[model samples]
Target chain A: MPLLDWARTQWDRALGALAVLIGAILLLVGWMKISDTGFVSEQLPYLASAGLGGVFLLGLGGMLWLSADLRDQWRELRGIRARLDATADLAE
Target chain B: MGILLGMARLHRKAGAAVCAVLGLAIVPLISADAQADATYAAVAEATGTRVILTNQSIPLNVAPQLQGPTASAVQNSLQQSDAYAAFPYPGEEVAGIPGVVGGAAGVPLPAYPFVIATSFGDGAKQLSYPGIELRAESTETLTQSTATGGSTGAGGTSSARVARDGDDVVAKAVTDLDALRIGESLVISGLHAVATASRDSAGKLTRASELSFTRLSAPGFVIGLTNGKFTLQNGTEAPAQNDVPLAQIAAALSGAGYPTTFQVPQETPDGIIGAGLQIQTTLPAPPAGTPGGFSGETPVTYTIGLLRAEVAYTVLPTTPAAADTGVDAGVDAATGVPGAPALPTTDLAGLPGTVPVLAPVAAPVAGIDLASLQASRAAVGSDVGWIYLMVAAVGLAAVGGCAVLYRGAR
Candidate 1:
């Protein structure tokens, strides 16, 4: 039970780290492609989209890392709501 | 564990949304890149040798008139003579007829006959025409103050100032004169003028008066238009004149009209004279069944007077060898002509020179080489690719930031 609890606590952090790694890899690949092709405005739109994707990944990772504790709080709120519903049903 | 699963599920959904938006944005970019590549290929193809030949006919109508003091004398003499009293004004009707004037010995005045003739070169050929007569249509005289011996606005009381008087007169002819042809030079002589100058008590020049006799010589011009055939005057052969393409002549006519005056040497008997010629084009609508009209193909004839010669020029594109011998090409190695450099010849034993030693010449480069052109095309392609990469980088960063914020809110 203790190992399961530990795994639950660390899962969001693990996901956040994975997202950050993927984002960084995407950025590296985009830069390499640009350097190989040579820089001009014709290729701007594609490069822009790839860069936006990388930024989104980075932001998602950061949020996941920052809100690891918030996930626990959300779970607790759901549990409390369920107990309140059960009590209400008994009273009825 | 359930909460962790829920968070993972939300993250997956958000990632999927971001991917979808990014994919949609990239579709247009890919199409744009393809279009740009096509344009670049077209440009590369267009970089080649191109030759253009333009044939143009220029119509020039010039009537140069010589007018001054001498012409006024002839006009006054003719008007005052009693023999010409029957008709008040003498012009084209009495142009060639001689009129006798009384008072001093009888002087004969030919109203329309040319007073002067000019011959070029060895005097084998000469052109003669009468001076266009000028009847005073209108005259205006203006007087203004001119600053003399003083700086403007100096306000110095001791500065000496003098009032200067000037007269400007513009005169028009009563009737239009005949058109003059190219290669015809005529002088309108017998024009006389007298000028008198007046000074103030201090001997400073104040006023000047001039009386001039007007004699006009209309300048000659010829417009030659030739498509395939040319017709000459019955008794005359082609006069000595420059032959230019008909299109070029037309362009000249379309441009500004001929010069107001023909340049004359200062020492010439006529002196400096002001001349002007007017050209009116009378092109009727093409007749029915003409090529330009609703139908047919019989060549239409246009008769433009005062033309010396009609000619045409056929232009052909230069072959590779022909192009190589052009002015742009270096000196010819065989003939040592055109742009060939001359080197000093050293003589041995001061005797007659042996076979002349020639300098080595570089071989001429042919038409544009494709290798350099291809390299430029590649450079442009590479630049376009780099721009795409840069835009993608920026876009990915922005999207990543938005995604992070969304997750944080969740």
Candidate 2:
């Protein structure tokens, strides 16, 4: 099955994963602000390049997660519609 | 009585005959011994030798007239040639003067290697240190500079003395000596062993020794005076632009080698100045034609550029005991040959008032030590720009890691 179809049946797992990831993001941001605040000015050139490189990597990962989450919802809704039609047929 | 007289006469006649025979027998042995000595003396005269140590030649007459063995039979006769004692001169008594004890004095008032000095104002009236020689692995004049201040009032104490800055100081020095064993290893052709060296009774170098070179890089800083203005040499007319900044000079020096920038700073009264050249450890070739003549010429080329030097210092006079108020510019006191053109001095004519100014050289970093551009990189301080950049990169990595984790959980 497509990964999106699989995620549709695993709502609890996806939400749990997202919560852990957000926590990690907050922790890393705090560490950077605390460890090297002066890095913003003194090494601006290097900091900008590194920041852009980091953002690209993160955006890619987030995009993959978002794509998988949407695909799962679509698969789950289709599965519900098919089951509902089968029930209606039994009723008739 | 007649019988006794006859017996005594007979004994005297017999004793006389025996003495005559003994004298004849000794004559041949004595003649043979004399013959042997004559032959050995001829051989020793032929074999004994002496060696030359300088421009002087050795006299060939010290061999003894006696000889024994043609080889080992001849006694080894050797003498120090005339060159051994010819280098006597009277000027070696002062400090830092180099040469044979009695030889012609080397360049006068010889300053030792690795020295640093700072001088300011007309006649170094503001401040100076006499002997601030710093002996280390290497030394160089990173910059020579001058700067002027806007005076608050004419003849006021503030306007009277030209405040000396470190950028106005000049210095140059050499750290290495090139020792050549060429002269020390005498090459001769007459002896059985070809060219051989002579050693003293203690088996040390008694004859010619290796040639060694002493490098003296003289960085010039003559103070000029005009009105109430003072400046280190900037080779220019404007007092405002006379100063050579130190930070820029240091960066250039630490990157290149010695710097040759002599910018005459403007003194209050005079605006223009011409700089004398300094070529230390100069090696002049035969000029493509002649064989020898230790003459002088402008062998090095002078370069110009804006000097930058960052001078970090404790107070010029931190302690009285540690201060050097008397400057013995050793050159003038030397005896034989004259010292280098009285190391460009400070002008006293326009020196404002009777301030009793002493141009004692303080440890001023010069910008004109550009004698060798090869070693400049090592002379400057360390740069830590890359380290700062790395720290910033790590900060960015944290941001990336956060994004990765957030996406993975989602």
Candidate 3:
């Protein structure tokens, strides 16, 4: 199957890949910005923030790609338990 | 007492023998030192060197005014021109007097003079007018071989060798000074060397003598008067018509008591070439009781353009030949004399066999410094390596997490 078709069937994985791609692009942009800035000591903070943000996005994308469906199922279970408690309170 | 007398006599005899040997050795050393000093003195004398300056009057067509934008443009053009490089002179010094106005003595002056003062009226009495003095100089060298007679050394061996001699010629332009004016322009166009030669240290012909000529032009300006009363204008406009005939300028200069008839030698001597112009003028003096304490009757301004060409013939001393062992006698027969000029060859048909093979030396590559290469590599590794590693790690983690989720779902 074509990779695009597979990504359509598995949207979570595709979203995770897209997030990772974005992170990689951000990292490349950060590197280019730092190089253009001539590695000035005053610009280190901005470069560090950009690099950290890219890493965080990559981690979030990876987690979402892996367990996005599982996370939705856990939310549905919590909602069912809350409805059961409300029905018992009405019977009392 | 007899033993003591005998010992003292023996000591005196030994000391006298030592002194005699020392005197014999010192005599040869002193003689050799004196001979070397004499040889050096002869070389330093540089005898029979000749310097000649032949002046050829080159007529001026139009005197271009050097002032304002035109002056600046000409200066820029001269700076970038090859003539300026060939004959480099101080343009500022050429235009003004050294140390009289305000410039370091011996420094190269500008080609144009700076205007110091200006005044109006015909009777403005001034001692002198600010005028330009143009000077140009060139130097060339030639070498000639002369056979020196054989001189016997201590061993009675005849040392016949060739000696080189240097001849120098210096040519300068001469002009009379009665036709110059504050706003007048002067242009000299032709100056060159008639002949030149170059030879190697061995006195062998490297470059033959050739006849050649160089055209050089030096334009000048006269700015102001010295007594601070006469008006002098240094504008860009030509003092005379741009298309004015050369004969007319010559006539006016002649009427003003300046030499207009410039004569040229029927034959220019070898290694000598020069050209220049002379201008002279008498400005009317200020009337009696004029302001600024003026008292001169009539001040005359005389300017001359001097172009000099100097040629130097340099001869390097003969280097001593290495000692010849018995093994080189056969080689000497084929090579002939050590410092003799090589015979002309008509063709290269026998060159493949006669030519000696030489191993080529390795040449260093251009534009590649090892230190810079290493530094650049280190910079790329440090700046870009971590980003690539982070991206790779994130990609692998995402792939692994996705695989685990798929398995759990199954």
Candidate 4:
């Protein structure tokens, strides 16, 4: 149960990090391809595909990371609600 | 059923992974080396005032003359028989073919056609080149010729003459202007520019370009340029521009009550209403070990008014580089020459060139001058600001994403 709880909380963050790392690597490779090539025509495909793909991965990683923050905020809101319910019961 | 349900839950991550892999794979596959779609050994072109223009673009190497079936037959006979052994006389011959009299020796060798000559000049009085007073002219003559050849003991000797205009290599282009009205307040006159190259008998290559103008004038203003020239010897490379003339032109404009702004030439999306001059000469290298041979195409171009020349060397798989939008980029209101400031004086002077402007000049209506009207119209021209702003927004979002991602990593 403890291991499951830890995995549940850290999964998004871990995946986000992996995605960011892969995206950065892709960007570096794309830049190297651009600088290594002689002709502008030869660089076009790599620029369009690798460049855009890296950007897409980076965006996805950022979104997933932000979602973790929102998930934590939601948990805090639930705790606050439960405490309010407990106070109301005690009053009753 | 359980596997399918699990796959559905992880579909987003699965899709992202597939896209990343596909994106990485596609780069190498699609970017395989493509052979050059087109190739040119040399190209030369020039333009000025739209009317005086010239282009001399010779395609890749070609044999000077064609050897059709007859020539081929002669070559075949020479190779097959003893035509190389003895000189064949007209009356007496007994060779490989039974009926053949003189053998291959009697057939006159093809004339060595080794010269290309092109010339252009404006003849009509049409207002094609507005600023030009004298007729625009451009000429290029290149010659590579062999005089005579004789076969001796299984080999042959031929005499070649590299005579460009007779053993000389020469390229010449000229565009001149008498007067031009850039805007309501500015008039330029007596402009002459020439791009020329010639090789002397001693094998010395000389390139000479000249630029001069009488004055840039308006109602109460006038300015003159010191002559501009660029001359070099025996080299394939030349300076990019005739900087002396350009600097003198700028100096003259600045002196004649105009702003001192020297702007680089750029391809403007919406063309400018102005006059410009450009001339280029490219000469091919002589064939190796051929004495007295001038081998190259000579092209001459002339223009007046506005001109645009674009030479794309390769067929790009994607769209070419972006041209200047001329939007939100500060430009002179009347002339549309970017970076040139608006003229302060509003005096509308009559065009004072040899070639007259026949159309009756339009008077300023409702107290608005032509320059101001031009500026207002330019303001309403296509705006590329939104596109740039969108790019900027995306850039900012990427920065924000980086910040968030960095913090999460930490």
> Residue B384, candidate 2: how far off, in angstroms?
18
Predictions in order: lDDT: 0.29, 0.23, 0.28, 0.33
Each candidate's fnat, listed in order, reads 0.14, 0.01, 0.06, 0.02
By DockQ rank, best first, the candidates go 1, 4, 3, 2
Tens-digit lDDT string for candidate 4 (B261-300): 3222222222111233322222344465545444444322
**Most accurate candidate by TM-score:** 4
DockQ for all candidate structures vs. native: 0.07, 0.01, 0.03, 0.04
Q: State residue B45's C-alpha deviation in candidate 1, in Å.
A: 5.6
Report clashes for each candidate as comma-separated counts: 64, 69, 23, 24
- Please state what fraction of the native interface contacts candidate 4 reproduces: 0.02
Which lDDT tens digits does candidate 1 get at residues A1-92? Answer: 86468557678766765676677566556555543321133235445655556666766765675566466557767878988999999999
Instruction: Decide which is better by TM-score, 3 or 4.
Output: 4
Candidate 4 RMSD computed on C-alpha atoms after optimal superposition onto the true structure = 25.3
Error of 4 at B271 (Å): 34
Q: Global lDDT for candidate 1?
A: 0.29
C-alpha positional error of residue B12 in candidate 4 after TM-score superposition, expressed in Å: 25
Q: Which stretches of candidate 4 lie over 4 Å from their true place?
A: A1-8, B1-396, B399-410
Candidate with more favorable, higher DockQ: 3 or 4: 4
Candidate 1, CAPRI quality class derived from DockQ: incorrect
